[model samples]
Target: MEQDLIVVGSGNAALCAAIAASEKGARVLVIEKAPEDMAGGNTKYTAGAMRFAYDGGEDLQDLLLDPKDERLPRTDFGAYTAQKFRDDLLYFNDGRPLSPEQDKLVGRSLETMKWLAGHDVKFEPIYARQSFEKDGRLVFWGGLTLAAEDEGVGLFEAERAALLRAGGRIEYGLAAQSLLVEDGRVRGVTARREDGSTVDLRAQGVILGCGGFESSRELRHDFMGEEWEAARVRGTPHNTGDGLLMALELGAARHGLYSGAHATPMDRHMKEYGNLDIPHGDRKNYRKICYFLGVMVNAEGKRFVDEGKDFRNYTYAQYGKAVLDQPGQFAWQLFDAKTEDLLYAEYRFHDAHYVQADTIEDLCAKLEGVDASAALDTVRAFNAAVDDDTPFDPTIKDGRQARGLTPPRSNWAQRLDTPPFRAYPVTGGITFTYGGLKVDDAGAVLRPDDSPIPGLFACGEIVGGVFFNGYPGGSGLTSGAVFGRQAGYGAAASLSPAT
Candidate 1:
């Protein structure tokens, strides 16, 4: 079929590009590597939390699926300004200044959400995981409050519906192999169908939104390190750097930190890739991110990171790599009964792995692959250091520190003396790779000289230089949507009128 634009992916980014291109009077086609049932890429594996700058609850109220939900009046959806968003991104940039891609992400975030809302993608407050009830009201911290209703699956479904409504077509089970370039321009793409048939589809423009190389063990070991080979994949196994490689083959400049990734603390025994057979909401249950409510210890029975250094949103991504770097490539999060009710629902999931004991000594003894005596000593030290004078509060950084330790707990530190104590075993789960093809602000793939590759645009994880050493929680989806929209517009503009 003749098309004005070809989008090589089916995730939020790809769909957004397709929808946007179609809106601009371009006939768009999307090619997916996964079957229709599992086609949303890593997007379906997320909790669908999207971090964007917003004025206040009013902005969020307008995008809510049910704006009149009873909680709107009582929920404190605090404002997250563009400056705050930029600050958060900079915090993870390893001391580098914000890149142009990051500036676009921050500046376009809220408008992109509004644009997505116009596409019928509904959102709701992420109350269950991001909020804490206090003073008879739900207060959301961490500058992230909204999420796609029903999480990733819901976000994908909504975007798919919007794309279809815009007259965009998606061919599932067709993996894009290489770009069809001619005269220094990308004309289309060659793809392989599930039936082993090959098709050379021609288009005026091609957009690669296909994802990163996190699922490729070889790529992980080559780019990150040998230890990353043992890291579990938290998303789709299909994102083996096909899009990035295809672009690189065309001399598209590689950009961003190839050695960096968005990793998280996940179930140590979770399947190599995410479990797609389960319900959408249950898929994210493999994550164990409530470490601020407790403490984490490596195999040597010693605390590795300052668990209370910051909110989980800021630290969880980097901590996963730290976990992978641990002696056994795993760690356990220990929580007492006092903070039991504060833990995320993932901790109580049926498949969640944990060990419980009535006494601290017994809990330490139950930790497999850890020195029991040392673990016991570590716990005793932690409990003794906790400043019991400071009142415990989850709504904000309460500054209840555990001081005078080798690596002190900076905030939210509490004694783990309450029994029975529970420990959840966790390991590093790679979400997406940080390295990808370079793209200009318009989302056009760039050559090493910083010139746009004619007729080729890129977005999503395929577009690099946005993230580096660590990632602020919930920004991946927003980045995909933001750049996807840009690439769509850019692709449409690049299309020849005759097409």
Candidate 2:
């Protein structure tokens, strides 16, 4: 099929880009392997935090502080990069580019947010006021963390519909197997449809928004190293990086494989928390404290990280355990009646949201196979730390603040002392990947020679440089809107001569 443009993913980024282009009077088509209604990409399962910048938008606090939900703090910066903002601990690679690189990337990030806000996407300013005591264990939480209404899916569908209204077509369950490149320019893409038939899409330009390679174990092993096999797949399950593979086949130069953004997200989410049901996987559940004040321990029941820190920082800390086989592989959140109460009273308003254990022995039985003995011992030690409100004697680097959590006077304060010592298992989920195909500011995929792949473009997760070193809320949608518009409009702009 001949078209003005073709996008190979149905994610928020892809959808946003398609709609942005379609709105501008461009003919576009979106192809996806996932079901039509299923928004299973990173957009489907994200914290959905929309981080507005200091550029010029909302009036918010300079620093993040959540009085009601003290567990997760909100910064005034909203993931903005500034001299006043402290450095992100988890940035392992050269994720944050300076000057020229920063110009294109940060400009794109800010532009994306501006575009989304202009498009009527709600942009809320988190932490516009208030201050609190830094028990030193406070973790940062965004407004976007826990809205599971599938609004993201709705957004994608809305965009897709609008795109179609503006003269675009979306073909779900169609997988692009390869790009048919002629000479140096990308001619088009050959894809597999749902019915096992083949369809060749010929376009004046092609945008690959299919997302990262997180689902492919082989790709993870090849690029991210062997340790990634056990790394949590916390993002959308459908993001298998098919587009990346295709790009490689077309002589796309690879960069930044040695580095990426990894985070340890809580596992057993849908099961343990009773959030959703999965017919394919086993029933897994744990006391859901991922959003609450929590503690993390390893295979030997040792406290690993300051669980209250930024979730991205938590993942970086887990990277330290990479050499330990399951280095960042498994972790557990240890909490009790008091921690649960604080979480509920201020953080989580739901009384029924906590895990209950009447005794240490009972809690042990519940956590039996996972880490019973170690958990029980850790509970006693934790209670001891809480009793005196003193620093834990253990020497965990950068993990002191979490270990220093001594709950301000409560009935259950010293309660490794009683029945039901509760423990909730925490494993990282892959909400997004910090790696992808290299692309220029124009949204064109970069070749081995650092030149644009003609008639080829990328936006969203398909482009790595735009996200900065770490992602802020709304950046994903913002990037797609900003760059998708660029790709679409730019492609449209380029077509004037032909007209």
Candidate 3:
């Protein structure tokens, strides 16, 4: 297959790259490892919220502190926080620093959100602080509503439709095996088809958006260490970080220092039975959120984050240490009668397939099951703190010092001495890796010295320049969209004249 632009993987970044390039009047082609009819990559299974910027109308302009593109509603948190992303990357290179250039990329992302939402990409702009909750004890019902697979997948299909309408080519059910670099430039790619045949694809430029290493156990073990096998893959199995490997071999660098990321049970199960656990017709109000919030524990039967905070931040980087310290790389979510009721209605409890016991003795029958002792102890300690004014200080570690938070988790523990205790057992490490090929604000891949890889562009998880250390809420896909467009537009601009 030959094209002006060849995009690897059908995930958010890959598809968005393809769309951006195609929209810029380039003949683009997107290849996937999955079957033609199957959901090929991770974006299909995402929460789909653009967390970069929100309009919030006229009164919310204060949030737009360091306005970059004038298109996205800028906020102090995003402006300063995103500008300071490089400080988080000290773990890799002490000398390398990212600053103002990143702000440019941030600006582009803001504009991308505005353009996409205006294009009818159904999204909810949320401007809440990021928080964490370990093992999801709070009974979260569904995921943040955004562009569903229908929209995400539809975006890809529409791009293909537009490309074909504009004379572009799309080859699915074919996996990219290697890059054909001649004269230090990406000219084409080697593809492996399902029928076990290899084809050499010629292209003017290539966009690597094949996604992170969620399905690649070898890559997982190499970067994330022990958390690899225990990591529950929330992405489409086809996105095993193949592009990252290809890019690395081609001298590309990684970003987003942390190799791991988050995938909720709601996200994991929904990939297959994922839809079943969501708020359906009659199953909506089976539990309350506060119940799930109260008893959630790490591998050690203790709360690690403020379950009361918004779900986006609470689940990302929080509680990962316990999984790294434990055997199964897993954690548990527990609750009781009244708690379950709160989860049902408030948290929108998904499925009934949880570890349930009518008595404390029965609940501790298994080690992986609910620990009656820990739950009992936690409830007792919390109740004592609440009634006796135990001067409880709520603080959590963010790979940094612990900051004091008012009203420690379970600040009002009412005691769990009653019957009908239940638990939801879920185990999955942070599967999203922030490292990949480095890119500039225009989403163009860069070298170690920060020079753009001419005729080469990248976005999403496949590129690392945007991700500093930890991720801000809505940043992953948001960054992907922002850079994806830039890469597409920027890559197209490189393909000028008689090429």
Candidate 4:
């Protein structure tokens, strides 16, 4: 039997593609590698934050479910214009201008969010992670303010509900083996069933959205350097580069930084892979944020990257590589009593590796893998460099920088002299690789010669070149949705005359 579209992988991207194609009167069939419980790929383990350009509070109010509430006056959501979005994307790309592919993603981001909202995917302010309540009003810092109603799980369930409502079918536990190409055109795919049987699923178009090589230690050691082998998989174990390999086999040109990925500081003792047995709320707890509120020291008891060089959303992705390069491939984040109240929700997790002491000297003694004497000295020197004249503020970039310190803290520098120090052990948690298939603005997979591969389309993490060294937090899902919608429309329209 044949279908109009075969969507491989049941993540946000694949689901968006399936629903879009089905809405166009195309029969869409989805292939999911994992069982029903673990179906959403990396989308299942995210905070579901959606980053898009908004004019201001009034612009955001148009997209929210409850905009007229009395609390609107107290809250301030600064504008994130299209120019700002383009600038942020270019900043990570080393100040180069946005490519046509990137321009398409950024330009259509707001539209994608609106489209998802029309499908019943609710949006709300990210209070827990992106905002702070000051003087009885919530102020959303950073450019990110909106997220899916209930976070990652909620976004996935909403997409699934929308897909089913549009007459789409998802088959779980059928891992895609390879693409079926005939006469230099993709026709379908060969997938392996859970019972060890092979089936040829034919369709007019095929969309590969399975994701990156973060879960494969061998690939990590080969492409992203050797230290990444010890890094924990922050998402699904099934994303072992299957879709990437399948496209590469068909002459798809690879693009972007092969040695870089979106890695973040996570709990050192979290499970080897994302645990499906735990609740979605517990899944996000593995991340260790609020590092900008304190200082991070290597096992050698020396400061590395400037913890406050920028907002955590801008720096956290690349900082993981610095931690992986530390001695024993780990680091410790130390905080004083002053900033303790401002710590993120993840700091309160029961399983997080942490120690508390009444003084800096006692806290150094409790840091197991870190050198005691060196850590104490590091803290003292860092405290001495803080510019005391600049008042501390967590809501904005107060220029309270540390002067004359090696690897200086650029902002939010407060003396760690207040009693009762706390520390958390941390290692790199890789989310996805930056290297993947090159695609056009419409998500059509392209060849080395810049020609689109007929009948082949891609979206989500599988479509590369959008992100380079550093990633602005919450933009991944936005890119996935924007490109996923295009890929679905492109796939169905490519065969419209014949259908």
Candidate 5:
């Protein structure tokens, strides 16, 4: 089959690229490794939280929240300017400045979000996950304001509908094995079907949005260390680095931190692999990340990362590795009734790995593999260190910190004296790898010589360098949309039409 553009991977980025290409009057074909029911790549398992720059509450109102909502009067979603977004991108990389391509991603974020909204993807304020009622006003922190109307699956369905409407075609269960390069230009893709049948798909342009190696045990162990093999996959099991491997075979320059990944603390008892059978609405229940609102102690009953060091969204991705490095490759998040209501929605799952008790000692005793005596002492010492003078607040950096603690609680530090203690067992759940084919600002895949590989483009998790060790919540979706759209337009422009 011949197409004007061949997009590998049926996820958000690929869909966006396909739609953009078709809108330019190009015939686009999307190839997916998963079956029809398992399409959308890692995006299907995400929260669909999208972080972008906006002026303030009034500006965010048009994008997600409604400024005139009767419930919020004093809430301030202060301006998140492009400068702030740029700073955050560099800050997480240890003050190392972003490449020109990364700067382009940040600069075009808001405009690309507007483009998505225009294409029928309804945006809604992420009140449930990103905001809290503080002083009678709903305050949205962390610069993440919006999510798709129904979340990840919702975004996926919407994008799929939009792509089909734009005259784009998709073939499921067909995996792209390699690129067809002629005269140093990608001419098409050679793919194999589920039945082991090979087919040649000729195209003027190719865009790779297939995810990373998080789901491949061998790749995980090779790139992220041996412990990664035991880590639970938080998304699709089909992301085996096919896109990355195909690109590498063609002399594409590999970039970013290959050994790093986006991981988080998930229920220790959840299935090792992501279960598609889990009700779509409840798929995210396996996650146990609200630990920043509490404390995390390892098997030896010792506090590890500073639980209150930052917002859970900002710190959750990296903390999973910390949990994996623990004695039993697991940890427990402890919280009290005082902040119990503040727990993220995922903690309420019926099958969550947790235990509840009226006393701290009883709670610690119930935590299997945990040292009871040390657990009790740790809690007592943590409580004693809480600066009682500082008022408790969850909406912002209230500076209610614990004084003189080894790993000090930097914010929202409250003593666990409120009775009815609870703990949730957690282990590392890997999301996606951070390294893949390097690309330019236009999403054109780059060769080892740093020159563009003609007619080749990339986006999403398979296109790396935006993130490293830390990630701000909601940036993944934003980056996909921004760069995906760019890749589509770039691909279309690279075509010679009827020539």
Candidate 6:
């Protein structure tokens, strides 16, 4: 195919790039490492929640597929201002200043969402997971309230359909091996087909959006640590650093925290690369993120982190690494019957693993790898410290605390004295690597000397430096859209007569 622009990968970022470039009259071709059914990178494995700044309910209502839904009247879609979004990103920056890429992400977030809506992608309130009904009104917390309809799969299908409608073409089962650079400028890529045939695809410009190296055990052991080698992959196994390696081989500068990643508390026995046989919605059941509703203990039967330090969205990404560092790379989350109704649906899934007992003593005894006696003592200490005067409320950070403990619970601290206590085993599941190729504001790959590489653009996980130690929840997809659009525009502009 004689294409004007080549987009590597077929995830949200790649599709957005292809669609945008096609809109600019560029003939775009997207190459995917996975077959068509397993395409869309880590996006298909997600719940499709997207975090962006909006003024209030009105702004959100404008983006919904059905603005006239009856529930919109009673739902409180609180404002998530641009300042709040910047604050959330800075909170996870590990004391570093926000980068230019992050600035673009924040500035362009809402417009990029609107842009997606303009492209026929639909969105709906994330009521099931992010909101709680209080006083006959649904209140959304954590500053994240919207998601693409039907979650990740829906988002992928919608974007893929839009790309096809825009006259963009996708070639499945073709893994890009290296950039086709001629005279120090990228021309296209050399890819290997699934049937072992090699093909040279030439184009005016190339945008690499494949993904990171979270699936590569060797890269994890080398860049992160030996402990990370044992961490289970939460997304596609095909993201084995192919894009990162290809970029580096061409002198692209490396950026971001290679040792850090977006890890989550997953079922201890989840299939190594995640189960593909199950339905898309069922796959998220493997994640156990309700630890905020209870307490987590390492193998030694002791509290390791302040479970209520913040909302799950702010803490869940880094907590998984904490779980990986625990003995046996596992921990158990214990909750009483009090919070049973408040737990996410993932906990109630049929395949969800847990041990339930009528008493704390019995529950501790059932913990597979923990010390029973010490666990009982720990539970008793935690129970004795909780302040019973404050009323429990799940809709907000009510400041109900467990005081005078070694690692005190700062909020939502309820004693596990109720009958039928339950414990769920969990371990760290890596979602994506934090390190990737450094790109400029236009999403053009930059050399170490900070010069843009001609005909080479990048977005998605392949373009890094937007995050450091951790990131706020739902920012990944938004980042991809924002930068992918930028890269597509930049690539198309490069093909102008003046260039």
Instruction: List residue ranges in candidate 3 displaced over 4 A.
Output: 58-105, 118-120, 124-168, 263-292, 298-312, 339-352, 358-371, 387-419, 429-431
> Residue 183 in candidate 1 has what lDDT?
89
Model 4 C-alpha lDDT per residue in residues 136-233, reported as the tens digit of each score: 88889889998886789889999999999999999999999999998888999999999999999988889998888899999889887889999998
What are the per-residue Cα lDDT tens digits for candidate 6 across 1-499? 5788899999889888888889888999999989999999988988999999998988876679888888888899899999999999999998888888888999999999999999999899988889999999999999899889888889999999999999999989999998998988899999999999999999888999898999999999999999998898988888899988888888889988888899999999888897667888988889999998898998999999899988899988898999999999999999999899999888998999999999898999999999989989999999899999998887788899999987879899999988889999999999988889888877889989999989899999877888777788999999889989999888888895733
Decide which is better by lDDT, 1 or 3: 1
**Clashing residue pairs found in predicted model 5:** none
Off by over 4 Å in 4: 68-70, 496-498
lDDT of 2 by residue, 1-499 (tens): 4567788887767867777767666678788887765543666444334432343213332222222443344332233453211233123224443433334444554455545434544332222111122345322333222111224544554455556666788887888888877777776789887789998887777888887777666766776677665555645556777887788777777754334543434443332121223311111122233332445566666555444344332233243233124334555555655544344221232322234577865665565235667767766666565444433221122233323543222212233454334565445443455566677656777887898878787766666654334443344555555556666665555443553
In candidate 5 the C-alpha lDDT for residue 402 amounts to 83
Instruction: Name the candidate that leads on lDDT.
Output: 1
Clashes of each: 0, 27, 28, 0, 0, 0
TM-score of predicted structure 4: 0.97
lDDT of 3 by residue, 1-499 (tens): 3478888877667766777787778888888777776543655444444444323233223222233534243322223233333333232233555544345555565567555544434442222212122243211111221232233444444434534554555677889999887887888789998999999988888888877776776777787675555555544666577887787777776665545454433211222222223422322122122322345554455555554343324344434433444444545555656554334332333444456688755664443644557755655555344333333222222121112323254343334556787665544434366656777756677777878766667777776645444444445776667777778888888896874
Across residues 313-365, which tens digit of lDDT does each residue of candidate 5 receive? 78888898889999989999999998878887788877777899999989999
C-alpha lDDT values of all predictions: 0.91, 0.52, 0.54, 0.87, 0.85, 0.90
lDDT of 3 at 79: 30
Error of 5 at 10 (Å): 1.1
TM-score of each: 0.99, 0.74, 0.73, 0.97, 0.96, 0.98
What is residue 48's positional error in candidate 3, in angstroms?
1.9
**True-structure lDDT of candidate 1:** 0.91
Cα-based lDDT at residue 20, candidate 6: 87
TM-score of 1: 0.99
Q: What is the lDDT of residue 163 in candidate 3?
A: 42
